[model samples]
Target chain A: MNIDPVKALEGKVERLGKDLKALDSRLENAQTDAAHEQLGLSNQLKDTTRKLGRTNDRVTELAESVHRLERLLVALNRKVRAGETRKADFGNWPEIEKKELAKIFQGQEAYSRKTFTPQEAKDTRKAIAEYDRRAHEAIEAAESLTHLPANAESLWRKHYKQWHAITDKHRPEVPDDDTHAKDTAAKSAGNEAIKRTRQQIRARIEDAVANDLLFPAWFENAMGPAAPPGRADDWLYTATDVVLYRLLHDVTSPADALGPAPAEDGHRKTLYDRLVSECAEYRRP
Target chain B: MAADPFARLADRQQSLRTALRALQAAGPGSPDFPALLTTTNDEVEAVMQARRDVEAARLTTPNRAIAAGTTAAALIVAVGWFDAWSLLSLLVAVATAASVLVDPAGRRLWEPRARTTVITAALAATLLTPLLHGWATLITAAGIAWWAWRTQR
Candidate 1:
């Protein structure tokens, strides 16, 4: 080894320079990589943020839909209850009509039995015609108003058809020269059948009530504590006749049997009271 | 509106109930009572009509096909566990199938919970044979019975 300190120092410095260059290159490369990684991370974060915003919007929409559905459910529940009450009220019409008819017929019958002058009889007939017209009008109103279940409607239709047949068979005719006797015979036969049918219906109603199969509280209230002792059958038959007339034909009320003016105030007032109560009950939840 | 007839009927029933409450609240004295009553009656008719429609709709072809598929799957599972336990599973599967077939509307049959119960029982029977021994099939019957009871309630 000759004395070459300067040369050796130069070599050492050159090696150090190379090492510094390499280090600098590594540091620069690392910085670039870090920057790329940060960019990637930023993009990912932005994507995630966008997705989160969409998710939040969706959740808000779903919550609104649930609220709407809840409101609908509450409204639907209330409607069902009201419909049930209305159905119950319509179901009561048959019983109410039966009770009212009973009173009307009883009044007509008592009047018919009393003697009256010609003028009074003519006035009575006119009143009877008016009552018949009213009865027909009531029936039309009921038919238009009532909407019964299928089974009940079918049963009603059958009864209506039977009533039409009975009325057609016994419709009164002008006393013609030759057909007067035949007309009388037919009327009597029809009346007998009507009476028999009324009796049967009354019996069935009584049986159903006695056996607790029916609980016509309204009917019982309308009938009051007691019907006149011997006139119960008459009352029932008269009511049945009223129903038949209402269903099928308009027949004169037996106002000829009624004296000058038939007092129907008691029966009318009682019926009105019962109707008001029924209406009140229908409104009760 | 619900596409399912039973669901439609339920909606109509709910509407009717609401109308009835409104009718009651209106009272007979209110001038609006008559109008409310008419609305209530209309709702009643709608409910009845919906019920009739439900009855008429009953089990459609798709429902029948699904029921048949379920029955076949049940039977296949039952066969896989052919033993004393198989009889119990088979009985349950057959009864469920029969009920689905016979009922006018397979409303309960189509319920997600009911389907889940039936499938779970079948899966339990299939998977738990080694661990539960013959008791796995019993689970099938019990599951079906529980589902039936729940539906009835």
Candidate 2:
């Protein structure tokens, strides 16, 4: 008896289809079991994909954040190295003075209410729609068939074959002559452009975080804080608060927005920095 | 003014085109893309979970209400109109009753992934299952009341 690989693959596929069907009925009586099983899986996959996207977005966004902090770190490092600035300079941020940071809460809250571009709003809607579509497909698939698409290698192979074949087909044909140097140069150029965009955002943070500089109009637009009529310190602290506040509330947690948390309340620090703070607050062994 | 306006317009168009091309480079299914897709996927799923929570919440209430309504209707018919509730109607009523109890019971109790409280509630429902038809009504009321209190607070 000849067992062809293709036939074997087909056999596996047929078996999967059959098993998936059987899983359907048994799963029905244990219906919620089956339903949620798919729901969780699909949601997980969808989430993983979305998370992957958001991670990319947040990373990119926070790449801006990182660059901002890095520039602050760099400038602070440079200042201390030059003996031109001290740790006291960081403490001098207007945000450090409670009254100064508090002054900008009004502006930051106003910024929060500001409408996102049609694109940003559209993206949020798109994320939601993509999630719903994939989630429904996952739950429905789980209910209809048992051979999990996620785990079924043979079926997945087939799925990959059918859906994953687009790359070669759509890929722009490379010119015969090598463009590696050109491509590398172009990428380097693009990287520099990205770096500049990043640094623009970061320069402000460095200004606020390290140098205690405040340009009210630019500060308000990018970092969301207006300078008090006379004090630069208020503007600086306000910027820090706005950035961190946006990270904690709008970007991460909605629960923080709901009611007074009272304990930690809406106040949270970066995990990395929080660890540092905790260490500072601890009694020495 | 027209030349200045046209130059500004041209520059704006060039900038807008540059931004769009950048986005196309970054769009979904873009090769070697960052993992933001996965985060978006998760947030999407969380949203989906929120939706499921709503549906699950709906099922828990309406289903038990269905049992309560049927039982009330049966009693009314038995007392007001019919000599006795027909066996067919009785079976449907019992099935509905069982369904009401079973829905949340399955979700909260029977589900392998059920939360501890839901599992506890399910276990409580199970212990009361022998008197399920009537007990289902009480349990549902309690669950709903608990939900309302928690939500309202």
Candidate 3:
């Protein structure tokens, strides 16, 4: 056991080196673990985003279905106001179909008669407006998280200031064009203006990131387009859009912005025609 | 308005908790096990997708230019000065030039085709500079040229 001191010291150094190497590997593993933790957090956020999108979609579908039911009630109300039978309005429907529709309408009248009066329609409009407000608020809240890269805020401020200066000097005046009668010329001008504005928007975006704006996770979760081109036949009109359109046009009922209900052959159908057609399919023999 | 996704998610969790409680209360031989399992699976998938979305969002780089531009344009509509707008044209031109110069990852600085197009556009702009009068024309010409070159290539 009486070993030389030099040899003993060398052995201790070798053991220390081995321990240091082991510690280094463990440290590397720890670093990797930290990276995985970061990834885990990011993954959790993504999961939330997807769930939100699904929920939003489901809600939109439910809203659209409710809107369709409301439309049917509204159409019935129109016939009642005109003092016309469902048969008279829906001419395309077979006699039996008209009767069936009448039965359906009458049954629906229990619900519609109570809540679908003109006053109720007005109330519905108000509710839809409120809903739109809430949606916009939520969207804005979600959009608030829109991340900007370094130096983006200052650049935006500068652009905002410049935009103020430009728009102040050149105010777009289209008061006359705001009327119900669609002015093609004004519309074209407005479109051109939009194009210009979009160009400006693109330029600003380009200036900021030299890339497309990062679509926020919440944005991805926002409800999908309600009216896809394929389903143009059964246009799922949201109550909000319909009410807003009617209000803006000062019309009793909103025009189906999603192209009017499908026409027969080459002839376009009126709202009355559509009501009849809808009634025909459900008519009883 | 659609139900807020966050709220909906919370509701879903609450529903799951309620279901789990019901299953527990019903004793060991609860017939709802299969349905619960299916629902749990769906939830897991949804959770996974949400996680993926989160990762995607993190990965996405925000375009500061667009944000600034949109903000500026919106503000202009709210409170703009039309007379001094032309003065800012120079600034816009400068911005456009700077944007082109600062291609992401310095790609524009490296790519040969991009360099050649930039040179050609600069030459064209220089030749037309005297006639065009303002930096607007020069910038516009360069931009158009660059865009056309890029698209064509």
DockQ per candidate, 2 decimals: 0.01, 0.01, 0.01
Candidate that would win on lDDT = 1
Residues B30-112, model 2: lDDT tens digits:
55322433433333333223333433543456445555555555555434443222333434444445545555423321121
How displaced is residue B103 in candidate 1, in Å?
A: 3.4
Question: Can you tell me the DockQ of model 2?
Answer: 0.01
lDDT of 2 by residue, A1-285 (tens): 327988888888999999999998886779778787998999889979987998888778877777556645654455556554322221123323343333334333333333445456566666656644543343333222222222233442342233222222222222322243444454455445434433443455665445534333323343222232354454444444434444333333322211222244222433324433332222111
For B14-106, candidate 3 gives per-residue lDDT tens digits of 444454344334432245544543453344334323322332233223322432342344334324433343334434443444454444112
Interface RMSD of each: 10.8, 17.0, 18.9
- Using lDDT, rank the candidates from best to worst: 1, 2, 3
Positional deviation of A2 in candidate 2, in angstroms? Answer: 99
Choose 1 or 3, whichever is better by lDDT: 1
Encode model 1's per-residue lDDT on B29-130: one tens digit a residue: 356755765676566556555654554464344345555665776566656756675566555655665555564243442233444455456555545554
Model 3 lDDT at residue B107:
24
From the highest TM-score down, the ranking of the candidates is: 1, 2, 3
Q: What local lDDT score does residue B144 receive in model 1, on the 0 to 100 scale? A: 72
Candidate 2, position A241, lDDT:
45
